[model samples]
Target: MKHAPRLTALLLTLALLAGLLPAASAAAPQPAEPRIAADSAIVIDYDTGETLYEKDADTMRVPASMTKVMTAYIIFEELEAGNLTLDTLVPISDFAAQISRNQARYPTAVPLPYGGSLTVDTLLRLILIPSASASCVAMAEYISGTEAAFVQRMNATAQRLGMTAQYQNCHGAHVHYLTARSQAILVREFIRRFPQILDYTSATSATFNGTTYPNTNQLLPGLAFEYEGADGFKTGTINAAGYCLSATAKRDGRRIISVVMHSDNNTTRHTDSTALLDYGFARLAADAPYTDTAFHWSWQAVEELDALGAELHPSGEQFRPEQAVTRAEFTAMLYSALAADGQLPPLPGPEESTQPAETAPPEDTAGEPEQPAPEPEPPFADIDGHWAQAYIEEAAALGLVEGDQYGRFNPDSALTRQDMMVLVDNFVELPEANGLGFDDDGDIALWALEAAARTTAAGLFGGSGGRLFPSASATRAEAAQVVSRVLELA
Candidate 1:
């Protein structure tokens, strides 16, 4: 719903790979544009609300049964209003019963006996699991007096949601209008608002009035077309709508929403969604990939960073595992760790600084005219436009980064274990050395001895043979594990 944000992430990656950056940047290849057979499709990161991929997504098409997603949304709204409960027995009206009994008209309907009753919970399962049309009509009548009035609510809700849609009915029977993009947005909102809806949508089969109804969605568990983590939403195939699906799935704690409209058939509809979902999943994984980290001893720490959120992902590149952690990388990780806890104070970028240079010439000169002073050495000459510039700048502003002897940050140079302790010591008082002593304590610089002793005593460095290796360069894996553990301690 953000302005022009559609496919922005994908376009940025594409533009970067199109010779805008080094070939190595593209070494972790971006997933190719999926071969989608659907007339329109879209995929979005459910967490960021950012579009990961799209194809003719804004072109309006009949939403078909996907419209039931909204029906469920409204029903959820009504339930929250105290007007209905899951166990509330809804009356089986003449209209609803008539539609149910009319096999030619409502083939998906599980025939309801006239004047009989089913609970709102049962009806919800019937509609979601079986794509039962009469169940929708029944629920709509109970909520708004008539399905026609419910359609008005649906359209109004769509408009309120800023969806490009025109609702003609409660269930997707006759016809309705919705774009693939809008459908994705609607489902995103629906799931966000009523995540419990998944309890019903994830069901592969349900029994109604002693007749069992299998889920029309083939993406559920144990089906031939089943996709791992495939859960809720709906499917439809009217002549005009063709085969359409609005589907969602979660893998590795990340959820994605996709809509495939006008696919050739039911199988291909799932096929198109699978491709879109896979594209989305791969894109997010690339942001903080662990494909290279699994063999490392700290692989769990690397994976935990993904669960910790985007702050840990810095520049969306895999950390060099065996390589030494750099000063800039440490600064970025520390900044992100503090930020994730909302502990970062007001800090401005280098460009936002208003202070004069550290060695500025005096404003008043008594005799000779003063010439403009030469600019003082920058905090770090190498950081401008660097991939970790923002984090480094913020870290520098907070005094978390101090450049080396020549006033250079040495952003790419290896950070030693003692140096890691010094930097980390800035956040909290490193526990005093107490009685702890390492075999290599003499190798630690006098400046870092207390921090080295304290951090080692704290078990940050799991020394072997009583040697802490204080001056040895810390690997990326060690840095990540240390930082992650620090976050947990914080």
Candidate 2:
């Protein structure tokens, strides 16, 4: 009997040790280090001012058009101080038009005929969006009466922002030198003081005087290589500078700024920037403590859900954390969350066409009978009489959801993690996933990679046992937690 007891104790000890080994090994998987084709690159966390990654960040190089970022910063400051207004019309001088003619070299210039009038807002858009050198001069002259005088203000502003750079002109057309570190600093402050610059930089195309000019930065909407959350910043290239880009993106609640200078080519500049952003996000995730503790995780999620007014279950008294969520249910939950956050647009009221009282005919035709308007068709085939009909319609209208190829909205089907990511991305701007590769990246569908990478970086989703179960069904509890987080952030 003594021998039997000793053997049993040894077997239990072995089993416990065996279980510990896998967990210990899986505790902290190392993230891949980022590499860039640029001669200089830097990535920083916007919230914490932490340097997530850098490569020769302080080496001086020709900044090219990126100098306009600083110029716009000054312009925004003046606007905020009430010294300049968006509607202030600036006269395009002969000198400005002549310099703008240098567009043959840059190919991003908007025509600025001498004596043509443009609002300050239009000129700023031309400078930031299309990289028109003439607009830079016009803005400088409008602010300081001459480009030389404007260059003085640029230098002064750069000094105030702690940017150690040599400026040779109002626009970045001359031999001006700026380090990646200095450029990032200038851009960070620009965004911090005037976050609305993103509205201009994020534009894929801007129209002035009926002529539409495409933005030089290709990482925006309607571009060849649009990154999900890329909103603002700039891109530049000169023979001497090669190619350069300063980019910023926000995901979840975290924002990252990346600068890549002296890339070998235009494609390489964008690629390097994307890689740096991925590395920054990966580092943030790796540094954060594991948030998957059993009871604590559930409790935290419950608090958010309660605050967001999320219902636990339809009939069950206990919250069934493992129950899968259907498409209709998830859409309703997301719609409710957006409504609670006041993020949804105002609903359209009854129009004159729909209301006979508002469209009453004159007294001479008062006796004529009013014809009833035909009912509009529902957006989805299967959602016509569904309980979640309104939610599905609103979601579809906002481009948040799409029906199957056969035009049938399968409302009862379970929602997959990949599908959820795609839906969430339509509402929230997601970060690029260039450098962050998962162990099971092959399992992710081609269409879902961008959303998965973004949601992962935002800390909204994570893989199970080092594998992202892209096709796995999302449970009701998980849906509640995600919706709550989105609302809280909003």
RMSD of each: 12.7, 24.4
After superposition, which runs of candidate 1 have C-alpha atoms over 4 Å from their true positions?
1-27, 287-317, 320-332, 335-490
Taking all chains together, the TM-score of candidate 1 against the true structure is: 0.62
State the lDDT of candidate 2 residue by residue for 192-255, as single tens digits: 8898898888888788768887887887766876887888789887778889999988766567
lDDT of each: 0.76, 0.74
Tell me each candidate's TM-score: 0.62, 0.55
lDDT of 2: 0.74
lDDT of 1 by residue, 156-269 (tens): 999999899999998887776889988888889988888999999899899866778888888889865899889967887777889998889987567889889998888899
Which pairs clash (backbone N, Cα, C closer than 3 Å) in model 2? none
